[model samples]
Target: MSARQARIVHISIERNWREVYDFAAKPENMALWASGLGSGLEADGENWVAHGPLGSVRVKFAPENDFGVMDHIVTMASGLEVHNALRVVPNGDGAEVMFTLLRLPDVSEEQFEADFRWVLKDLNTLKKRLET
Candidate 1:
């Protein structure tokens, strides 16, 4: 199935982009702010296994880089893959974090909106954690 629908949920953190990226890019640290991974992540060969809000899933993340990209793909128990594009960009003295939320096939508008809010809440959680 094709995922043509998209929404970007973003937040501005009062911290350096590099610092934000450094912390958020680590899979083990995601559970601290990213509620979906509240159970945390553990190494599973090339990917990480997270017993998240969506049940157990395999996550493949992009290699660490200087460009502040935190992209990752989550593979569900049924092998449904969802690509998540996340980025931390410089915003004056602070940082802007963005997450692209895709409304996959058969997702209703209400569910998509809820997903958008969920992403925003997660970003805000990150902001609160880092800005402290």
Candidate 2:
């Protein structure tokens, strides 16, 4: 079987890049905006876990840095790791947030499209929460 191509979904937020990055960089704040992670995050030793729609999943976030990189890896209980490459780049006085969604080997085109929609919704939610 051929591998599926990854896709990127992004949104522009009317907020300072640093403000958006600060809010997103913190793992604990995910549930506030991300519906998929609405169950929130819990510390589990070196890793973090969240009860997502799929089930309890482990979350590993990129270390804090000056750059607006808030990438994270969500490992499902079944051991499938979904890498979410999220970035907050400066756009004038606001910011542009982008997320790269990788299509897993077993995912069908329909499912991949649905995932893209979900990410877009989440990014919109993030924007609303920050801009308000």
Maximum-lDDT candidate: 1
RMSD of each: 1.1, 1.5
Q: Candidate 2's error at 2, in angstroms?
A: 7.3
In angstroms, how far off is 23's CA in candidate 2? Answer: 0.6
Computed on alpha carbons, the lDDT of every model, listed in order, comes to 0.93, 0.89
Per-candidate TM vs. native?
0.96, 0.94
Off by over 4 Å in 2: 1-3
For model 2, residues 22-79, the per-residue Cα lDDT tens digits are 9988888989888898579999987898887878999889999888998889899889
lDDT of 2: 0.89
- Give candidate 2's root-mean-square deviation (CA, Å): 1.5
TM-score of 2: 0.94
Candidate 1, 14-123: lDDT as tens digits: 99999999999999899998988758999999999999779999999999999999999999899899999999999999999999999987889999999899989999
